[model samples]
Target: MHEKTIAELAAALQAREVSSVELTEHYLRRIETLDDALNGYITVTAEQALEAARAADEARAQGRAGPLTGVPVAHKDIFCTEGVRTSCGSRMLDNFVAPYDAGVVERFKAAGCPVLGKTNMDEFAMGSSNETSYYGPVKNPWDTERVPGGSSGGSAAVVAARLAPGATGTDTGGSIRQPAALTGITGLKPTYGRVSRWGMVAFASSLDQGGPMARTAEDCALLLNVMAGFDRRDSTSLERPGEDFTTALDRPVKGLRVGLPKPFFGEGMAPAVARVLEEAIDHYRGLGVEFREVDLPNAGLAVPAYYVVAPAECSSNLARFDGVRYGYRCEDPRDLLDLYTRSRGEGFGAEVQRRIMVGTYALSAGYFDAYYLKAQKIRRLIADDFARAFQEVDVLLGPTTPDTAFRLGEKTDDPVSMYLSDIYTIAVNLAGLPGMSLPAGLADGLPVGMQLIGNYFDEARLLGMAHQYQMGTEWHRMAPGGFN
Candidate 1:
């Protein structure tokens, strides 16, 4: 049961081979026995999951089951689940309980998927490694001593370790794809505004977009069908009609044009990861796909620009967390100023504070034009570069991260080095493009992933291409030793 994909599980449920209650109990037991070492989940809602599963079983008995009925999944802690603790992996909101479900949560519940629990994440989705999470770092399932990439590391780890068939994740500059790359799973980040963000704790409003993570692209498609929809409450939500993300899964790749970014193939990429990506490209080539080299002239500036834009938005979004309202507060305050200062200082972790300070400084009166404005201009250049490249190619291909998963604590002390971990993925968010990472192969026993970027609203093509590649390789089928 643990080894099956969501589609397979759904098929079994339809066939009456197993009950939703049985499937739910199976995963709950796995969490109880294996999650201590991984620390992949912040809260496990076993009772709620069982109750949902029971309802699903009744629906199935009544012949009203949906495609995803009874499928169990975990939500990234950043998404609010009414009556459940949506901590966002921060001490600041450790005691916070949402009064309503996030738009993504409501959609999944409507689809009949059981909510497993909320997975751990970087504090307010601020870090590259899961080490910055308030509930301690999530360990990579492949090697316990290695780090799982963040801020969606917990979601990636849970899916990679088979703790859940699928999970929800947000990518504000590679949180979903980076972790998915390191952990050897399929993760997707839809075009900005393609998915609703209401009730999802803001990290950076412009960059934060929720998507799906799972062992295979097919599973990701199934999950995205429920997650992508417009919500009137979220101003950024796209008003496009609903889509069947899996519609193109079986599309032929013959004559498909794939663009390889010259910048991505240059320096900073590990030789092993590069070699694996080349092999994957060759596999695609054999399928009659044509590859061409393209240039993203401003790609080099993406990191600095993202740091500025993301943090600035984060500063504005997180301003609502002052002790006067909700979330954590100091036990005693001498004055109003003391209450705000102490509550935030004591509640937020070092990384969160670092980003907030950087963001606040960037948005400050004197530096706003010099820093923030310039960064936004550079962001436009990056988006324009992708726009130009897409005119010649159907999709862009590259390595997901510069390297495979690093050992835990290897880059923690050097913030610059840590930030560079996402060097390959940040530009996609800057451009609001649809992107995905699929397992390519293993290098030194750790997984390597190949990334695919598509034009705006081109997710079906991205998922279809990834699914085709997965059909020709066994990388997505490989699981961590003990977990399987």
Candidate 2:
């Protein structure tokens, strides 16, 4: 049951072979046994889960279940849940429990999915590695010594280890896809406005978008059907019609034009990772998917621009964590200055503090135009590069990360190196485009992901391609040796 995909669980529920309550209990028990070592969950809502599962069971008995009814899924701790601690992986919000559910949580509950837990993440969604979490780092399922990527590391690790069938993740820079890549799971980061941000803690507002993470792209599609929609509360939320993401899973990829951006395959990429991507492109070619050469000249500038823009937005977005409102306050303070500085100093971890400082500096009066404004202009150029590539191809293909999962503390010392881990994924966010990562191949006995970027609102096509690849390969089905 642990190895079964979310889609498989849904089918079992529909067939009456399993009850939602039973499924939810199974996952809860697994969390108890396995999560202590992984440190994946920050909060486990046992009572709420039981209640939700009971309701799903009742709905299933009445034959009123949705496709995802009764499936247990985890949520990233960053998403607010009424009466549940939504810490955003920061000590500042260690005691902050929201009064309302996040848009994603509401959607999942409405679809009759049971909550498994709130997974850990990078503090304020600020790091490429989960080490920035106030709770602690989430261990990679593949190799416990290696890190599960951030800021969705816990979510990715849970799904990869079969702790939950699927989980929700947010991507601002490569949060969703990078961790999924490292952990051997599939994840999607939709277009900028596709998923509502209401109740989801903001990191870099303009670049933030939430999506699904699962063992297979088909499951991601099923989850996305419920996850994507219009919400008035989120001003940036798209006012587009709902989509059936699973509709085209069986669609043929014959004659599909796959664009291979030369820059993504250039120097600095690990030879093993480059080989895997080359193999993936060849596999696509065998499926009659055509490959074309495309150049994203400004691709190299993505990391620098993202560093400036993401931190600047994060600085502004995180200012709300003052001691006055909900979240951690100083034990005692002599004055207002003491209150502000002490609360923040104790509340934020080293990495979170670093990003806040960098963001604040970039947006400061003297540096705003030089750093923030220039980064924004460069962001436009990156988007333009994608625009030109999409004009020639239906989808773009590349390695999700430069390498597989690294040892837990490998890059923690050098912030610049840590920032570069998101080099491939940040560009998609900068362009406001939809991107999905599928298990491409393996390197060093660990999984590597192949990323597919599509034009805005082209999630369906991306899923279709991923589904086709999964059908022809078994990469997504493989889990860690101990877990299996």
Clashes of each: 0, 0
lDDT of each: 0.95, 0.92
Give the residue spans of candidate 1 off by over 4 A: none
lDDT per residue, candidate 2, 1-484, as tens digits? 8778888998889988989999999999989988888999999988899999999999988888999999999999989999999999989998998999999899999999999889999998888889999999999988899999998999999998888999999999999999999989999999889888999999889999999999999999998998999999999988987788888899999999989899998886899999988888888889999998899999999999998998888888888877877788898788998888888889988887888899999999899999999999999999999999989999999989999998988999999999989889999999999998988888988999999999999999999999999999989999887666
Report the C-alpha lDDT of model 1 over 430-465, residue by residue, as the tens digit: 999999999999999999989999999999999999
So what's the TM-score on candidate 2? Answer: 0.99
Error of 1 at 159 (Å): 0.5
- TM-score list, all predictions: 0.99, 0.99
In model 1, which residue pairs have backbone atoms overlapping below 3 Å? none
What's the true lDDT of residue 458 in model 1? Answer: 94
Displacement of residue 405 (Cα, Å) in model 1 is 0.4
Worst 10 residues of 1 by lDDT: 317-326
